[model samples]
Structures are given as structure tokens and as C-alpha cells.
Target: MLKRFPFFLMLLVGLAVASCKDDEDKPPVTPAPDTVSFVATISGSQQVPLNASTATGAFTGTYDRTSKTLTYNVTFSGLTPTSGHIHLGGPGRTGGFKVPFNSLTSPITGSQVLDQQTADSLLAGRTYVNLHTTAFSGGEIRGNIQQGTTAPVPPVEFAALLTGGQQVPANGSRAGGALVAAYYPATRLLTYNVTFSGLTPTSGHIHLGGPGRTGGFKVPFNSLTSPITGSQVLDQQTADSLLAGRTYVNLHTAAFPGGEIRGNIRERRLGITLGASINSAQQVQPNASAATGTFTGTYDRTTSLLTYSVTYTGLTPMAGHIHLGGPGRTGGFKVPFNSLTSPITGSQVLDQQTADSLLTDRTYVNLHTTTFPGGEIRGDIKVK
Candidate 1:
């Protein structure tokens, strides 16, 4: 027994030595990433009181939670920025400056140590970055800071500089106006704001034609008042026409019945497309039906707003909802559609939690019918 005990002791020591050697041979543990990346899309349309400058920019940064340090870089074109800074503000609301860049140059780079309050605001997306140019001293290009490595897709922007020279046969009227708008491709919706001066506008319409041609009226302003603001859901053909730069905004007046001032609509950037395919198979309990549908929409990250259109073929839907769940999973409802007809179109403001789930591809559209009380058709939303 004593001799066996000695041999067992030696075996135990040998095992311990081998285990230690194995530990040494294994790769070193990689430290978990402590930095969170953030990004923003800068444009003139994002300014508090929207500007007419065509400048665009991008802001990228990384926040180190451990060190409380923020490192950032800014790149822009089309404007000679005189200064820039980070400001404490929310979308459409202005606030005081929080941090300043060391230099006012394109491809601006710097680092700052943020206090607890500023850090919290930044992570909550309550901060914005902007650049001031001679033309727009208040800030020519601006964007709200949002968390994520990839910049959120910006809404497609369009603008028109109305002038008498662009009018068909040209006009001698000393008047001018401007149009700034955004188009969401998924919902086929266009929201515009127009401002004019030196004319009492009698009527205004978005005409379908090129720069020097006169065509039929497409969309009309809800009001002839200055600062006209409204939205319109366009058909596929009209949307295509606008994207082709074949549309113009024409404001008619008592003096010039045709058009006092006009400008061709020009696209600043293409829009983001989000869509889903609906079928019975995606339901928690798959149904045996020929019903199928599609959901197409766009999410404006800056406003946390979602606009969508749903169309189905085989099922008579009684209701529809946005369910919080991933593919093949059942979850609670997050949003309800305003209408249940064959084609459902609506917009809703999403809370942070719901928006996060949507951006992560963890939400779906479920259409309920009388035959299937739960859901007749389901589709997982995806960004394209």
C-alpha cells in the first residue's frame, strides 16, 4: 500500500505539471471590447431652422466606457466650415455647446474626456454635431449623434431653388422661393416644406417635367401659405419620375398664372428601403393557406418615426400589428395598424426599446383574420 501511494503521488504531480503547461500553451485571453462606436449623417436639412446649403458630411466616433474618452473624426464637402462643435440638444431642438473641435477643417479629428452628464446625454442620443459656414453661420450641416458603428441610413433628401429664370418662356418677376423635402422609398411618401418671398402665391403644385419643360400637375400644396408643409404618398410612376429629376415645384401667382418661380427637384441622396414578405408559414403555428402579403416601409432614425404600407392577396385581414419577436418566435404586440383593409398605410413614432428591436431585425408584421384568430400571415421585417 505504501509503495502504491508513492506512485499515485508521482502521477498526481505529473498531471498538475501537464495541466500548467497546457494553460501556458493556450492563447492569451482577449480583453472584451470596452469601446462602443457611434456615427451621424450630417446634412443641411438637419439644421434646426433648415438651410438651403447643399453641404453634406459624416461624423464617426468611438466612446470608451472604461476611460470616459471620446475620439472622433469628421469629413465633409461643399462648404467651407469656419467652425464646428458638439452641442447638447435633441432633434429639432437647439441647446448650448458642450465641446469644440480643435480645428475647423474637413476630416476633423480630436478626442475629449467627457463628464458623466455629457456621456449619458451622448449615449442617449441627446447630442448633435454641426459645422458653421459663412453662408449659414448658425450651422450649415448638422446631425444627431446615434449609437452604432454603421451610420443610420438617412432619409432621401430633395431640394429646389425656385427662380424666375427657370420658368418656362422665362418671367420678369423679381421673386424667389425654395423647396426642401424628404422621400421615404419604402412607404412611397414625400414630405416637403416650401418657403417663398416677394409674391402672394395663389397656388402651387409639383409639376412633372424637366427644368425647361411644362408638364401636368402631380401634387398640390395643402395651403398657399408661406412655409407650406405637407406629405404625400406617391405612386410608383410618380416616385420614379421625381427620382429621375423630371419634376419641379411651381408657385403660381395672380401676375404670372403659369408660374412665378420654379425650380427642378433634385435628389441629394438615395433612400433606404425596408421590406418584408408575409406568408402563413412564418406564424408561430404555421397555417395552411395560400394567403401572402408584403410590408414595405422606411424608418427615420432622427425622428424615430416609421412609415409603412402593407398589401396582401389571399386573406381577408381583420387586423394587423407589429409584433416584437424574431423569426419563428411568438411575442407580444408592439404597434397596431390604423386600418385593416387590403392595403394598409400608416406612420407611428416608436419608443427607444421598440426602435432598437426593429433595427436589430427582431420585429415582424402579423396580419390577423377571422379564419386564423392569431395570425393569417406573418412577415419578418428586414433592411435591404
Candidate 2:
């Protein structure tokens, strides 16, 4: 009986050892996912007003629920893009533009912090990305910013060039000013800076009104000094009004009690970089001049303004102009530069028709010289 008891004890010990071994061999459990992934296969056929373009693209993104930040990358082939934007819409629908990407080059990558409203719409699969090309100024490739996983839960920039002419009763103050501002949607905070010259600012306020009109004050600066820099938390109504372009910065002076210099607080739209490589080869009738040059500029859609600089080598430019034409073609002059010297820099406010032509890859830069007579060098202006 004693020997049988010993055997039983040993058997129980062996079983316990085997159980411990089994537990050690088990796999570890996986933690829950913290980020959501999204993807889109962009195609021309997906455009609201579909077209026959054969270009295709891919968009991949990740959204962090806790941080409310979206990181994305976009790649495409078969077309040169002019601009890209994220719009609020669903499949087969058209809506207003929400976020404009800072760059048009592929593969485009960027990170943006979203506000509660935008984040909700994104998670609900109610947003889409549209890429615009010269061939299709509206949109060439379209993709719905859809997500496979679900979770949770933003910056608008604006600027203004202050001038006396913008004042309600246009002043002759020979003074100028500028205002640059950015609004964070997440916290409803607006940070701004106002700089002025030739005026002693006694007071300043952001008033509610359109161009050439005036209304009640919505926001008052904490300081009346020049180069006023401050931040304020805005309510929903005030933020909406500001974003809708119904606000202006008014600086009051002793000489002008009403206002001295005023500027419309316009939302700075996404700007497109335009460039051209000017050589004798791009002329309608190609020449053999050894001169080469480069044209670079930024086009602001909101202001219809093109600020540009031209640089050249090996030739003396007599005159230069932006002509309306496609690549390898010729057309009439649309915009002439103020100076013909090398490294020419200037800004021009384009009419609607001329702006449209420029956006559609139908414009060229022609630099004429006495030697070449007609045109010493030419290059097609295009989105870079």
C-alpha cells in the first residue's frame, strides 16, 4: 500500500509539469488596432461628370482616431496634374471643396489635422479626392476617400493686402498694410498678424461685410500697435462668417476716425506653381539660338493673380509676353510683362477668360530679342 501511494504522488506531479509546459507553448494575444486604414483607386471614369481620360491613380491613407490626424499619399500616371483637393461628397455626387493639397507632384503626401466635423464626414465615407489636369480643368482622376475600418471622432488659411482703396470711403492715406491669419478648426483658435506702414494705428477691428461695405465689429484686437500679433478663440458663428469671406480688417487713425487703411480678409486659396523652360526649341518655328531661360511663378485662384520671375542666359531680351496658345502652336498676346530685363519679376491680375486659358495649358511665354526678331525663345507655361 505504501508503494502504491508513492506511485500515485509521482503521477500527479508529472501531470502538473506537463500542464505548465503546455501553457508556456501558447501564443500571445494581439492588441486592438489603434489606427484606421483607407484606400482609393482613382480613375477618370469616377469623376462627377465623367470623361474618357485613361489616367489612373492610387490613394492610401491612415487615420489616427485619438489624434484626429490623417496621413495620406497619392500616386498617378498618364497625366500631368495641375491641382488636387479633397471634397465633401459621396459616390456619384458633387460637393464643395474642403481641403486643398499643398503640392500637385506625384506621389503627393501630406498630413492634416481634422476638426470634428471633417473627421466625422471622413469616417462616414462622405469625402473624395479629385485631381485636376490641364486637359480636364474640373477634375481628371476622382476617388472616394473610403475606409475599411471604423473608429471615433482641422486648418483654413487666409490673407489680405491692406490698401487705402479698400477702405469704406476710400482714403488717401498713402499707407499700406497686410494681414496673414490661420484658423485651427480643432480648437477654434485664430492666430493673426497685422503689419502696416505710413499710418499710426489707434485702433483695429475685424468687421463683418463684403468688399466696399461695412458692418458691426466681430473681433477686436487686444493691441492697437502696428504689427499686431495675437490669437483668439472664436465661436461657431464668427468662424463661419470669417471663412465665408465676409470679414475685413479695419485700422482706425486719428486723421480718419472711420478707418484709414482697410483690406478684405480673403481666404488664400491653394496656389499652383507654374513654370516653363525657355529655349529656342519650343517656338512655333523652332530657332537655333543658344540662349536658355526659366520661368517660375505662383498662380492664386482666389485673387486671379500671377506673381512671376523670369531668368535667362546668353541673350538680351527686348520684350516678353504670355501668349494664349497650346504647346507647339501660336496665338495672340494675353499678358505683357512690365520689364524686359533678365530676372523679370512682377504680378498681374488676370481676367477670368485669360485665367481660364492659363489654367488649361493653353498659354506660352515668348521672349523676343532683336537678333531673333520674332521670338528668341519660347516655352509653354505649365503646372509644375
Clash count, one per candidate: 0, 2
Candidate 2, 1-384: lDDT as tens digits: 887998999999999999999988999778746698988877665565554355778888898988989898889888888899888886556788777889888999998988887888888988888999888998988887778632111135566767676686775688877776766566676767788899888889888887768998878988877668666778887788888877889888899989998878866555878999999999888888999999998998757898999999999888899998767678888789889888899999999667755654568898998987689999899765
lDDT of each: 0.84, 0.79
RMSD of 2: 20.4
**How do the residues 1-384 of candidate 1 rate in per-residue lDDT, one tens digit apiece?**
887998999999999999999999999999956898889999877676665566789999999999999999999998898889999886666788878998887899999999888888998988999999888888998888899988877657787767786788777687877788777576676777799999998899998998679899889987988888777888887899999988999999999999998878876432336799999988889979899999998887556788999999988888899988767667888889989887899989889767756754668999998999899899999655
lDDT of 1 at 171: 71
Candidate 2 global CA lDDT score:
0.79
Off by over 4 Å in 1: 1-33, 50-56, 89-94, 115-121, 151-154, 161-174, 182-197, 202-264, 268-384
Model 2 poorest 10 in a row by lDDT: 148-157
Question: Model 1, 53: alpha-carbon shift in Å?
Answer: 3.8
